[model samples]
Target: MNTLIKQFTLFVVLTLFTGMAAVAQQSDYQIQQDFRTEYNELLERIDQATTTEALEEIEEAINDLEDEYEQHADLIDASSNPDSFDGAISTLRQTHASAVESISTIEDLNDQIEDLETEMEGVKSRLDQLSDERTTLQQQIDASTENEARQASLIRQYRENIEERNLFVSNFLGELLSKYQSMDSAQQQEISEAAGRLEENPIDVIKNVINEYINMMDQSSALMAPDYVSMKAQHGYFVEVWDSIGEQLVNTFAPENPAQTQEEVDQLLTAWQSSITNNLWGSIRTSFSENGVELAEFNSSEEFFNALNSYLDGSIETSVERNSEEDYDVYREFNNFWSNTVKAEWGEMFIEGDILSQSQISAIDMKLDDWRDEAMPTSNLTFILLIVSIAVIIGLIVLLLTRKSGESKA
Candidate 1:
């Protein structure tokens, strides 16, 4: 029994010793595996680092791993074979040596890289300057190649424009001279004054002269138109001017404002209306004398009407024997003569010539329409005045007759 008990105790001690050895060996292998993995990872970090700063960061991690490896040195040495610990220690020593060697060369390598970059920048700047100079030289060559053709084209255009202007001036000046001879004193003075302002530009001077002359002829023609015969006679006076000028004045220059042009001509006609009145009234008096009805000399429109009324009354009383006041209505006859002969002659002129275009005819019609519209209000006021005058005159006659009858009776 004693011997069996001894054998049991010995077996138990051997089993415990073998287990402790196996545990220590396993711990050492684990540490070796961990160290190998960490060392490999740090080496990979160092190889991947591009900058000196990044390489220094890996160097810090390596120093930390090395401190931890030394702290576990006794356990590794006691628990495992010397070969296992030696392999890890040698790997750490070689890695430290390589890191120190790499750190020593870093500053010089960075300086060399910076110098190369500076040299490349200078080369790039010089190449850019040379490229700019080449571009400038090419541009100068192209401009020199095109200069002769561009100059020739400009000269050709200049000559053509000068020739066209000369031809226009020549034709216009000829027509202007011929028309100047036929213009009245007022028209000549107006054109000469306008032309004097444009001495620097002969073309414009002649254009203004032609424009003024045409405006006068148009006004004269319009004012004389209600009497077609008189209008035709007036137009005939300027027929040569019309033939020479043709539609050149209107066709060459666009009227700035057609309505304004008509207004100006109307104003001019008003200023020159004395000549028209003399022409018309002189013709009337001459015809009346030819008809053997002697008229009293009259200057005013009112006196002229009174002389006409006296002629009509005397002529009617001698020729037609009438008993009633209505039969001897001399005023009505005067009104008829004024409305049918004089007013009708003064109203609208019928345009019937090739010299005036449709546009000009329409403009004339518009002017006449405007004048008639403006005159309508005045004509109504004039009629009202005539009525009031007649009523006052009748009342005065009645009052005089009543006073005369009362005095006779007394």
Candidate 2:
């Protein structure tokens, strides 16, 4: 009994000591593997902040860390007990693989983002250039439109100046020509030779000729009383009156008197030509004197056009005189008839046989009526013939039908 008790107590003591040792152990198959798994997970998290500053850094880290984790995972096995250590290691390895693969995918996405940003910057530059070009083209279009309007205005002014200067030259020279022509043939030949020698500086010639006329006017005025009209005085008087009537015309086109630009002079001349042709000289001059230049009131634009047409027609008439006299006579008779008819019609329509305020449209209506009258004779004849032809056709059809019906009945 004493030996069995001692053996049982020894066995119990050994078992308790073994249990305590097992509980105190830092590394046993299951415990060592749990510590390793926890330590590896902490290491993976710490290493996740890659020190290398590139997308490729994560790729390298994934390969290196995944290999290390798998090797560590192999240390725990299916043969191990308690903690099912092999399963834990397998789960940890799979997590490591997933993390590594996720990092690689993220790195690829980041690289693609960088390439797209770079391409976007290039596109932005081209868009900026297109915007700049569009602005430049719009500015050029505006500048061109302004330049064209300015050029048109300048051209119009230039034309008017030329006309005025030419008119002044023509009148002054015409006076001299008339005087020279009155002389004997031998003296006239001498005058012509002298004129041919004068150089054609239009401005110089204009100044010289106008000054001469001015001097001639001064001498004549000095010789005569204000009310007295001598032969020389009469000529000067008419020139003075004409000059008085020309003030508005002169002022309308008068550039700075001390020095006129070439373009201005040219345009003044053009205005003068139109003014002279339209017989608006006195009216234009009076308006200019009153400091009121309403060119629209003159409405001489039509008169100017009509004068040009008349001059052209006169030349054509001369040519027509050489052709068949019969045709010429026919044309003449037609012209006379048309003119008389128009004058008679216009007088009756607008005047109310005397005086009436006619509208612009009413005037046009009057002209249209006259034009219609011209065509009425021919139209009336055609209308009559058409009615007769239609009636004859209808009569023939009726006769034929009646005759056929009568024969059929017989």
Candidate 3:
């Protein structure tokens, strides 16, 4: 009976042990199955992710999976039946990291593009406001025709506003140029396409600004009484602005045809220069004619200076030979011409526009000063000659009177 009891006890113990082993084995199999299922789901999610946020969430889930199955790594590897859990996890981590990095780069590029667009919009808004103010000031100038002072004031204000607007545009272009040069090819292309989509592309804005300046120049050239001083300032400002962006404009279009783009830019600059020359010379000719100084049409600055020098030399020689009071009036007239017309009206224009060198201006000034010295003598030689003649006449009268007295005494 004791032997029978021992056998029953052995059977019961063996049965409980087998059942427990089966349960533990089943639990490990479930764990492996759960890990695989989650891992596959994560792979799909990583493949489909298009944003950093989505990829980050998937990465976190992957980390959790790794942590949860860390203790059962060997069992999970065995359950894989030819694939190790660790190898798969490594691949998943690599893929997840790559996805996250790619998505993050894309997001960063998109953010940069957005910032550029916002800045462009702000520039457009400011330009629109300036345009409105300029229009109002122009209207005020036109309506104040009866009040010359008011008209002049309004015109000055209008010009100041234009200068401000142009300066802002130049600075904006400079900043954009720096930004464009700093960008990678991909970012550059993206920005170029985006700018092209706007109502006015940045290239078109540059072109339009140049065209507007040219138009203003043409208007000034056409005027019977052109404001040469103001026109000179405006032209100088336009040149400065163009110099800042002209290279960028050419580079922007260089991908298509570099030579043609360069030719077009050169043509625009030449037109600007020609307009300035025509306007200044036309006004000078009119002023010379009004002042009784005959000035012929000149094709070049050298020709103009030669003709002026010759005329001044001839006038000086004539004044020296005549030595009359009329020459003094001529001196005053020529001095006024030099001071008000040559120096005041056109000197700055010629120098700033690079039409004439400083040495050329200095040479002209020296010639004018020499002519002034010759035309108006400081010694008063005419007065001295008159006094000597009077003394001779008085001496002759005294001798005649003394001879008459001797005859009366005889």
Candidate 4:
């Protein structure tokens, strides 16, 4: 009975020891897995770090991971699994490499930021120099009262300097605004202040530009005064200015301009409509009335176009015979103004159903086509004359040669 009891006690004791041993081995395996998991997470964070502070945080985590890894190193080394030991060591090396790469990235970003700061400083310096030069030039321009040419030269220089400075401001504002969101609070505030100092409101710029165009057009009209040839050239110049101003208006509201807004764009469009109606259309109508094509005489668009074509084709033909180069130029200017400007207005009116119907528009288009076809014959008139002149010269030469041959035979 005593022998059986001793055997049973030994069996129970051995079983408990075996269970404890298994639990300890499982616990070690869990600890190693946790370390690897933590190390992997640190590596991931290192790769994603954008700032010095973030990198520093990742560095601390890496260090902690290393300490934990060291604590388990002996256990991992003693474990029967060679793969577990190798994996831990390999992960440690990978974490170090990740940290080094993160540091390099941070350094590179810092260098880029420094370079940008330097470039911006240079721009500000140039801007200041230009402003000083402009001030000095303006004083010179103001002092030179009697010498018109010298004053003009000084004014031109002043204007050029101002334009350069303004261009710098525009470009700087654009660049700063684009990078603003990526900036820290302090950097954003600094850039915002700088941009505020330099930025011109796009709406104001557009208004000033349009006003300048209007003034230029008015001046050109005055220069046209009584000279028909100069009127044509000036009209052509005015058209170019008008088109260029329209394009400038579009660019002013472009996405790149920081001050562009929907309300401002609407105001600009309204201003354009008013300017076209009062300034451009009014001026053109006045000019036509002065030229003897009474616009009021034609109630219908058909009558209006017919009278215009007749004046251009028939009435102008006799005048062209006595016309000089200047007259031809004036005539060409009138032609273009009629085709480009007047026709544009007419088309708009047609679309609005204000003056012409769809049928009327089509009729006028056909009439204009027929007129062009008729004008084709007139276009070839010069060529026809050249051919006739050549034929006459050849006949005269042949007659002279025949007479000389007959005389020689005699």
lDDT of 3 by residue, 129-173 (tens): 887787678677768889988887888787677668757866876
TM-score of 4: 0.35
Worst 10 residues of 3 by lDDT: 220-229
In model 2, the worst 10-residue window by lDDT is 221-230
Candidate 3 yields a Cα-based lDDT of 0.71
lDDT of 4 by residue, 122-172 (tens): 765675577567557757866888999998787667545644654565465
The root-mean-square deviation over C-alpha atoms between each candidate and the true structure, in angstroms, is 34.2, 31.9, 11.3, 13.4
lDDT of 2 by residue, 76-190 (tens): 4443434344554455456555665666655554564455345434443543443344344434444555587764554444333333433444465454344333445443333
Selected candidate, larger lDDT, 2 vs 3:
3
Q: For residues 296-386, could you state the per-residue lDDT of candidate 1 as single tens digits?
A: 8865445655675565546445433433344334334544444555445432321231223345435434443333333334445588889
Q: Score candidate 1 by lDDT.
A: 0.49
Candidate no. 1 TM-score: 0.25
Q: Report, for every candidate in turn, its global Cα lDDT versus the true structure.
A: 0.49, 0.42, 0.71, 0.53
> TM-score-based ranking, best first?
3, 4, 1, 2
Instruction: List where candidate 2 sits over 4 angstroms from the true fold.
Output: 1-86, 144-410
Candidates ranked by lDDT: 3, 4, 1, 2
Per-model TM-score versus the true fold: 0.25, 0.24, 0.69, 0.35
